[model samples]
Target: MTPLDKIRNFSIIAHIDHGKSTLADRLIQRTGGLSEREMSAQVLDNMDIEKERGITIKAQTVRLEWKGHVLNLMDTPGHVDFAYEVSRSLAACEGALLVVDAAQGVEAQTLANVYQSIEHDHEIIPVINKIDLPSAEPEKVKTEIEEIIGLDASNAVLSSAKSGIGIDEVLDAIVERIPAPKGDPDAPLKAMLVDSWYDPYLGVVILVRVIDGTIRKGQQVKFMATGTTHLIDRVGAFTPKLENLPDLGPGEIGFITAQIKEVAQARVGDTLTDAKKPAAEPLPGFKEVQPVVFCGLFPVDAADFEKLRESISKLRLNDASFSFEMETSAALGFGFRCGFLGLLHLEIIQERLMREYDLDLITTAPSVVYQIELTHGGGHIDLHNPADMPEPNKIETISEPWIQAVIYVPDEYLGSILKLCQDRRGIQQNLTYVGGRAQATYELPLNEVVFDFYDRLKSLSKGYASFDYEQIGYREGDLVKMGILVNEEPVDALSMIVHRSTAETRGRGMVERLKELIPRHMFKIPIQAAIGGKVIARETISALRKDVTAKCYGGDATRKRKLLDKQKKGKAKMREYGSVSIPQEAFIAALRMGDDA
Candidate 1:
């Protein structure tokens, strides 16, 4: 049995693009976890989307041997959307390697993740990475870390992950500084399943951190949360690749493949214990994740409904955060209303469906849940879709979800950032400065930032700012549902709920954007944005006119005038009887309006 003192289970935590994956690659190379010929950039990032985007979407674990110590390294996603996954990764580790880019210093996500690690009570080893870059400012970043995060930076390791500089020191720090795992191997089996995925042949494969006792092949294990039992078909460790192991003892990170068919059966945070002699109680701190943002996902083709459903089930095997239910839109047809952790999470899932499943999807604008109290009665209902909202007269009060957003930016752009936040009706919570950089906190409506706030903030700050947010419950706001009409017919897919103050501006923008997107048809089309029954803004697309004068060759001026009059009358008749077909591109344009600018 591997001695508990020789085991060090830890994760690398950092903001996105701060060299977490690169440093993980260096560590894997240094420890001979993967041979020199087999090493590649972002070795821990397994998905094609992850590699292309240069970000980790899912947390991955690997076992390494360094100086007789069994070091299990977990690489976690850095984006705010996957913060919950990062938290789960931190729970399995005894320590964390906090990586910061020397050039970028500290950002919003870095601070958020640092606080998460601290909450987990994990020993943190600060590392200043990318020292080889000409813009590297290790000393400056170290000072920032010390001043902002309140961690000692004098001993922080300085390294260039790309150049393999100071990697030895990082490995040494893990061996000497991080505490080893401690648990009783002789006790009843207890393991926390940190991650899980479905396999075609082996069925559900669960990645677990064995907290107590032992888990072995052929033993029956019970999932405490689901109360399901299955005989373990195989037990293995990821030495960069899955290799069979006879048993996994306490403090070891490995995988257990049973005949469990459904991925939900082996949920993350669920406890796995020996069925014959289960632990007296399950592990502590198991909380199910709830999705915050929701949108409708429908296939462009009606026949692809089954295909979309099957694809969703397959994707659900890998991602457990997203939830979906059958929803039908009058315009969009049959689809599912899917919920996500955040916008980025929603985008990733959509991209996966398109790339992996070869699906063409039309996704509605994302929305947050609102609580609406009935004036007629005293009861309230949660409204996720604007189409499902009760009549305005029936609502006593409507409360929209709000979030506490923290932004880190240069002091110079403070005014612009604050203005942008105020435009979104954000309330200033506090503001402070750290090392010439400003940290601004605001309580903003979640709907405001859910769509294009991040893109706008980055553009305003010239990409020098970073932001993170957490839901702060709901608050009463003067909100109204804005509807879009094409040729005086309301388009249900283009309806959105917005604040009263900016309703006109938003509506005007949508109408103008739609005018540019919709192609000129045989009949004039009027694109109008209306709140309730009143039109707030309108734009018109002129009809495509065919020159009747062109056919009057060698004719008199009177003949040409008569032909023009005849054409005008025909166009008027066609305009009254013909219906304009709005193209799919127009809908897409409306969905992405204000996002580009």
Candidate 2:
């Protein structure tokens, strides 16, 4: 084992596509963590989705040996949805490599993650990445780092990770500048459960950073939060691939298999201690994550409901932040009301369910949690699903979650971005200039921001704008549930809570989109969007008519009139009694209308 003074633990934090993973790949290669034959682009990103999307969904850890010192590096996801992952990774390390795109300078996520590093009291090493690009201005980025992040970047490393530039200098800087972790090996085992995931062969594999004492194979460890003990089956570190180790000592990061059946039991951020001699107190900074978005997930075929449940449970073992509970929809049948970190998280979970488990799913419109204040001295209750919302009569006031967003954009696109925010009922909190770019901060309802807001922001800015947001609590609003009715029957999956001002336009958009999506039937189908008893928007799917008049040929005018009257009567009766057969495709397409609208 390396001495405490010779070990450096650090994580790479950056904005999306700023080359965090590429830097990690270069580090692993330079340190000989993996051979040339085994090396690949984004070597640490092992998942297929991560490779395809070119984004790290989970924070990955690797142990490397450079010169004489032992280096523990974590490659963290840079997207706003995975900020929690970055934070967890930061908690395990004493230093962070703050990567900034030389061309783009400081984006929103760069500031966000760097602030998190500062909060963790990490020694941050500023690295100007993508220096090989023609637009790259390493000096400008260095200034931005100093001005925006308030970190001295005069000695910041200038490198192009793609071309392996400054790789050695980065290593040298890490060893010289980043402080060595200080922990007590003589003390009882106190490891931080940075992350955990399910492994088919060995069960739950936990990634831990040993803070005090050592963790050895066959040692009984207790999870402080869950109050469960498990016998360690294996101890190892990821050299980009699992390599068995005898034990992980203080200031070292590694993995351990404890024969735990589920990852839920090995909670992330939990303290792991020797079962025989438990630590006097668990480590601090542990808090449960509250999901920001909620939606119903149902198998397209009702027969696959049980399979979906099994698949979701298996998925939950991998994602501790995702939460789900059983829910039945009148239109969609059995399903689970699942909560996620954000819109991207919802999409990833849906995609994984379909791809990994081979399950076809129907997802409802995603909505943010609402707080409903009841009338007559009734207590407040958190509303997850709009369909489950209490009656309007009992609701004294409905408050929706709000978020404070920081957007970084070029000055040319500032006007358009501000307009888009205003259209979402946003209130501008502050706006300032950072070099040629504008840093605009706005407080907007989370419900408005959730639907295609990021996509809109990017398009308006020509993909130059970067945004990051955090929940700022709830505020009272004129919120009302808008229910969509097909053939005058309410579709629970299509129901959503909306502000009163935009209800008409949103309702009209949904009804108009549904009119195009739902196929015509023998009887006329009336699609209506309603708020309470008021029908805000309405559309009619014209009936598929037969040529009853054509069969009449050239008869008396009354004969044609009589045939039309009879047909109209028959259609009216069918409209009254006939149930609309809405295909699964319609619901799928209708929910996506929010993005388009």
Candidate 3:
């Protein structure tokens, strides 16, 4: 059982809930890498949010030393928002063990990660996980994996990570096949921060793979991006548990702690090297992540805004993917303007913030970007945010984001789903029957998918359909600008883009919805949709004059005026376009509606 010669650096990749963590647990135990006292049902799910949501939001690394070869195992987040995190995990590995669910087969995220693995030029070993399920059909899954992931799965390791069935085969397969990381162990210092976290006690704990040279405790190191160098205080590896490694070099994965207090200090792609003898260059290839879904997140109580801000700051330090900014709206009050990888990413973040930070928040609906057209004099200007929306009678054309969607559903519900797509303004392209199901492709507006898209899919397919999409670029479609006017003033946040075909429908629905959501005020609210200054659709919220007449409590009236002043102050912060007080949530919620039509 010699250590260096048999070491294998591999990561388990899968789509969300495909059981990457469960498989990790079995491998750690099967390799005799951990004791009974150390093994838990899902030992790798160290965070409370992950355990509860049953999803891995962060990447975790552990080592299984077997037959003298140390097999470094990294588990990655299966969701797309964590795709960047997945890429970071891949950078630290020499090979990837793709775990395909035998029953569910391949998904969009599966393709995403496979593309990522190929992009990294990783050696991939396919493993057919979840083979114990009644729906499990290993041969079908194998073929699909090979077809979709463009990988060889002929000798796929079939196993149930839960019962530990055939788990040893998966381990031996990695040892026999996956090669050790190839790098100059004696070269100048260079390392990759695969994933990291902020330990209240230990500061920024980084999981790094030393590509060359060596790093040890108290060594002054430079972080390539932040330029905030620090002296390493501790170095260790997860031998299924924290076993301090004196130093890390080529072909090994381990943890190192710095006196640095924040996750920002240890940027994932930053190269760690001795300032005196740095590597010729850091490992190339790091991408800036952009959030797809934007929404307003606020504490129900204004006092908790600061608390929510602190929580998000701490959380983002560990998760570079999580992004947010302070935002306030007359309709939604004060909260953080947060961006997510997508819808699921949005949900998981909200849930984590609530569960971990223990803050109750009001989340406004989500929205997508709209192309605004402002016709000032004889010229025109296009805008993406409502803040840039044109004033009434001065706008000529407006556009919304669009997409080309492909939905895969069961044969039984094929007809129903097709009809649903058509109803949502989707131009059906082709329907191919694959195996016993149908893969339906269509060109749909991104605005359509921003709202009710998921719910519609579930309804039409009876919940058996699955799909994914990439921005195919926008078209000069029939989109229109709609406004929700409050007190004869347009709220910038509420100015939005809608398909011209549905502009009236959206205007009416949003007005009605807003009227219900908005509290009675001293003024009437009008929700309207206009095409070239033609008011095609409109809704109004009647003003209410409910003043307490209980002797107008002398000093209490002053307190009431202060509260009214605060509310007015809040409303004024929002961008004004026309007469609509469109809150941030209304903007986001409309797009997140996921209803293409």
Estimate, for each residue in 1-597, the C-alpha lDDT of model 3 and write its tens digit. Answer: 123556788888787678888888888887777877867877888878788778887788987877768888888887755767788888788789888889988765677677788888788888888788998999998888776566888888888888789887887888888877777777888998887898888888999988888888889898876777788899998876778877887778899998777775677777788887887777876656666666678786788888998999978877666678776666556777777777777787888789888998776556665554556545545342344455556666655555666677888998888877786788888887657777788887766675567787887777678766666664666555566565555554465666667777777666666665555545555656555557776667665544435434667568787766765554444323224434444455543433432
* Arranged by TM-score, best first: 2, 1, 3
Separately for all candidates shown, the number of backbone clashes (residues 3 or more apart, or on different chains) is 0, 0, 37
Instruction: Give the TM-scores of the predictions, in the order they appear.
Output: 0.94, 0.96, 0.82
Better of 2 and 3 by lDDT: 2
| Clash pairs for candidate 1 | none
- Cα-based RMSD of the predictions, in order? 2.7, 1.8, 8.1
Which regions in candidate 1 have their CA more than 4 angstroms from the true location?
301-303, 544-576, 595-597
The ten-residue window of minimal lDDT in model 3 covers 573-582
Judge candidate 1 at residue 113 and give its lDDT: 88
| Candidate 1 per-residue C-alpha lDDT over 347-366 given as tens digits, one digit per residue, 9 for 90 to 100 | 99999999999999999999
> Among all windows of ten consecutive residues in candidate 2, which has the lowest summed lDDT?
588-597
lDDT (Cα atoms) of all candidates against the true structure: 0.89, 0.91, 0.73
Better of 1 and 3 by lDDT: 1
Best candidate (score: lDDT): 2
